[model samples]
Target: MTLHEITYTIKDIQGKGKGLFAARDIKRGECILSEAPLVYVTSNLQEALKSIFVLSKKNAKYFYALCNVHHDISFEFGIMKTNSFPLGQGSTDAAIFRVSSRINHSCDPNVHQSWNPKTKKGHVHASKNIKKGDEILKNYIPILQIQEDRKRLLQENFKFDCRCSACTKPSSERDLIITKVNICTGLVKESAESDPATAIQYVREVLGLLDKIGGICKTSYYYDGYQISAMCSDYSLAQEWANLLLESYQIDE
Candidate 1:
């Protein structure tokens, strides 16, 4: 389907520094409008590919061909390069299309992306009730990071310095976010090697952080729950958290 035909609407997002797709109506999970190529190369000859920006003639031709077949190719490719999440072992050679990308990056985001390789798609769902005009956002990196690191990564990759809530907050508040993130990270790490009692303590601490930050750190809570459940060898609990994560973010199983 064409971009214009899709259920979502493309609209200008403030502070995001780009136009983004927003839902015009409620949409369910696993709804596929388009599947973007993970990597497009013009030349099968690897030597011909030099920079990431320059699509080789062969790849460009392929993209053009796809554009002919798919009306949304240009929009797909534009969003793919701009917001697609990297996949594979390394080098970000592969990417997945996601609504979370449209939401832009925030140190504290209200939505998150969960990739399902089985379906070759990434699902974007709300971490909270997002008002009609609220700019949907996802953390480009782990939510638990110092503002400096978050700013640095977003600037380097997205090419725009973030002006999200956490980024624009006073230095004291930013440090609080960082400190909470650190506490969560430390708890998760220590839980990996410690006794169950210690691990549970860490889990509680992480959950405390989650309560403090609200929806912005939903992904962190989801991950922590999954890890703790797995450590206890409780697949059911793990599955529960996994489902919670998927449901909260509209992730595809």
Candidate 2:
């Protein structure tokens, strides 16, 4: 997707400063935006700073406009630390895209950022149906994490207090969500090999929990559900789940 096709706009989000906001109501599974990075750098900060200075004039201008969350650091390195996301499976490579960087973090985000190595570009997909005025949030940490760990990571790295519903929930309520997430994940791992049938049931539970917990992009779960269904030779169920997974990706295969 290009800038022209993007359905969101950058606007001032209260308490979060600048953020990507949905310009119109967005359907679940819709591609929000996709773009090639302005620059790619090694994990080394010194090299990353050197790399940024050498970017094309236009790219450098755009990069400089991005928010720098770290105030007490070098401006160039600060932006890199503030906005860079991994470009591959390893931490050694990173990429920065103008629009993607503006997306704010939420403990319960409405979007999922995914990297497509084949195209060498990254794309954000709506995790749940988003309203026109809603901010297009991206979770900066793992979704399965408990509230304390999530907030601690954000505080240490981004230097902000997360006030999202999931983060602010009382321990009694928060623990339930954490417990359910762990149960679903553990069930999938344990049953996946020994009991594929049970794995399918566990995957269903996972998808349901994900939807309840604001979707955390649940796309991965649907894919696993499809695979498990196929493994059970339940072609009909496999096709159904495959269709849902495709809808979640909004990809034309």
Q: Top model by lDDT, which number?
A: 2
Query: What TM-score would candidate 1 get against the native?
Result: 0.63
Off by over 4 Å in 2: 1-6, 13-15, 44-47, 71-73, 88-91, 169-171, 251-253
Q: Write the per-residue lDDT of candidate 2 for residues 26-86, one digit (tens) a residue.
A: 9877888888887676757777778788988988899999878798988887888888888
* lDDT score, candidate 1: 0.54
Q: On a 0 to 100 scale, what is the lDDT of residue 167 in model 1?
A: 71
What's the TM-score of every candidate structure? 0.63, 0.85
What is the C-alpha local distance difference test score of each model?
0.54, 0.79
Q: Residue 99 deviation, candidate 1, in Å?
A: 7.5
